[model samples]
Target: MTSGKIGNQASLQSIFDPIIAAPSDRPFVVAQLGQSLDGRIATASGDSRGINGAAALDHLHRLRSNVDAIVVGIGTIIADDPQLTVRRVDGPQPIRVIIDPKGRLPATARCLATGDSKCLVVTSKAEAVPKGAEGLVIKASAPRIEPGDIVEALFKRGLKKILVEGGGTTISHFINAGMIDRIHILVAPLILGSGIPGLSLIPVGSIDEAIWPKTSAHVLDGGDVLFDCDLRHQRRG
Candidate 1:
């Protein structure tokens, strides 16, 4: 649930109700990103602390609560070392998913180490799965696992709905592959003149060729804006 007067509890929850109700037999993918006015997700040093305020973070937690699993890429693991758990809010811990097709994440990494929650490491490292994680080794190249294959695997694992919380490259992968069902982009107040961008995998010849999702936006607590974009058309196209 991103965008528009999220202050109302009922209204905020309503935003994600449709997404949460997506057909359960298949994988419903929702991608979330918090970026700057200039479109950078993080600075050159990879610091993304508090880009969006507490309210936005709470929203993220709620989204996580609604999903059956959370997916991310190795870049996110390396840069943020995110726990990928619900801490600020009260909810069940959704399964944590990491897309490290090469098995790049170290065994000591937070997402793989503590085992506070179940984690699925989607990799091409077919030989071994780390101690605290399960492996879904796609027969694809390292760092380029097919999103469709990953979705199918997750569905087989009983995870019908997936929330992809990502670093730029990972988001771009799903976007370029046209596997995303919806998008929730949080735009913060600051700007980074040069750094990592939000989505970058698609190439367009003109503004008319740009991929546009049906969207809406609303303000958050700390001068940030949430953009709730429906992208089912992409999935069909």
Candidate 2:
């Protein structure tokens, strides 16, 4: 077995190479989710703390440090209230973004607090921007904002490397919309039996209809398995 110390650094660099080398013409979007062995992100009550081990958590912070911006839905803000800062390791913090189409984000959300990183809220044209944060309004008749529009707007703003750090629904939308280039799934060695699932894409009639991205797995410290899935070529047409 490979030592976590030696393997972790090499694996992280390898995982980030594609993202760091992406072209500047468009946004290179990656989504990440931490789930149980049974694919549950949280319990039914939504308590999702400490699912993956310290090494996986450090890897997440590393990802945040390397990316230009980190995006999440309002649901994650409400449920987790994450700071979205790079604290586990010594590196620059990334810009924090939120997808709150209906203007549901609270004024005092932790992510909105001032820090080294700026915060951007993606909302519908009619929604009011939350105080203390910049806004990127997209035209949408429905309450939901399109994932593609969000990506395009960010790219236009010079945030070409984007990380969709999520609460499942947000990640699902980007993945289903074919806007994601890669996905990193960290699965812990425990099973919740029943809880919030990690991904919820559209239904498929047969096994052949399921997605099959080019994937590689690495074992993190504390027995968590990280699946690095390259979805750039496998996205739906």
Candidate 3:
């Protein structure tokens, strides 16, 4: 892991010692996002092309270069049509995993187009898998697939290091379920005024009931702030 500096002299490793020290039994899930100062991930139109500064973008690419697999929700696939491969960084690209509960991702999606890495489509339905992808049918207990189920499926497939890039809902589910082992969030200076939230979940009655993770803050290349939070899955009682 590269040393991303904190406020003064704290190293990224120092801030993430707990997370780095975690057992390697299963994939170490990391949730990453680039949000606005107002905590909005995208504008009202769902545009999230260039919110992150160059440095943060590079950081994101480096992150992508390291993980064994990358995961995103079906909404992100439909909205961004991302080719979730590592660019602007030197390393092997991670496998792309898409959670499309209904198996609705279009075959023409960019992620399904071209990349050296493999793409795994996770859906609850056993119907047709999108072209250029492998299918893993995980039955849903609710209207949607559960976070724990996704993790289990990936882990059993030997995906030991995972990164989850987002479009809010998927990240919220993982966060609320305490399934996130660590997170890398870049808070930009721009404000969206009105847009989709970075983390949208059920309301919490009190701050005391919140799950507090050990964190380290740092300013990126263009004055954008990066917050690295490591969760032990322990919530305050």
TM-scores of the candidates are 0.92, 0.93, 0.90
Evaluate all candidate structures by whole-model CA lDDT and list the values in order. 0.82, 0.87, 0.81
**Residues forming the 10-long window of minimal summed lDDT in candidate 1:** 1-10
* Better candidate number, 1 or 3, judged by lDDT: 1
Q: Output the lDDT of residue 159, model 3.
A: 81
lDDT of each residue in 54-117, candidate 1, tens digit only: 8789889888888889999988998888889888777778899998776677777787765367
- Candidate 2 per-residue lDDT, tens place, 158-235, comes to 899999999799999998899999998998999999999999999998877788887878888788888888886553
Residue 155, model 3: Cα distance from true site in angstroms = 0.5
Q: RMSD, each candidate, Å?
A: 2.6, 2.7, 3.3
Q: In model 1, where do residues sit more than 4 Å from their true spots?
A: 1-3, 114-116, 141-143, 234-237
Q: Residue 155's C-alpha lDDT in candidate 2?
A: 89
- Residue pairs with backbone overlap in model 1: 4-218
Candidate number of the best lDDT: 2
User: Clashing pairs in model 2?
Assistant: none
- Candidate with maximal TM-score: 2
For model 3, what is the error of residue 158's alpha carbon versus the real structure, in angstroms, after optimal superposition? 0.7
lDDT of 3: 0.81
Q: Which of the two candidates, 1 or 2, achieves a greater TM-score against the reference?
A: 2
lDDT of 3 by residue, 17-89 (tens): 5435556786688899899999999989998878888878877777787677899999998998888888877
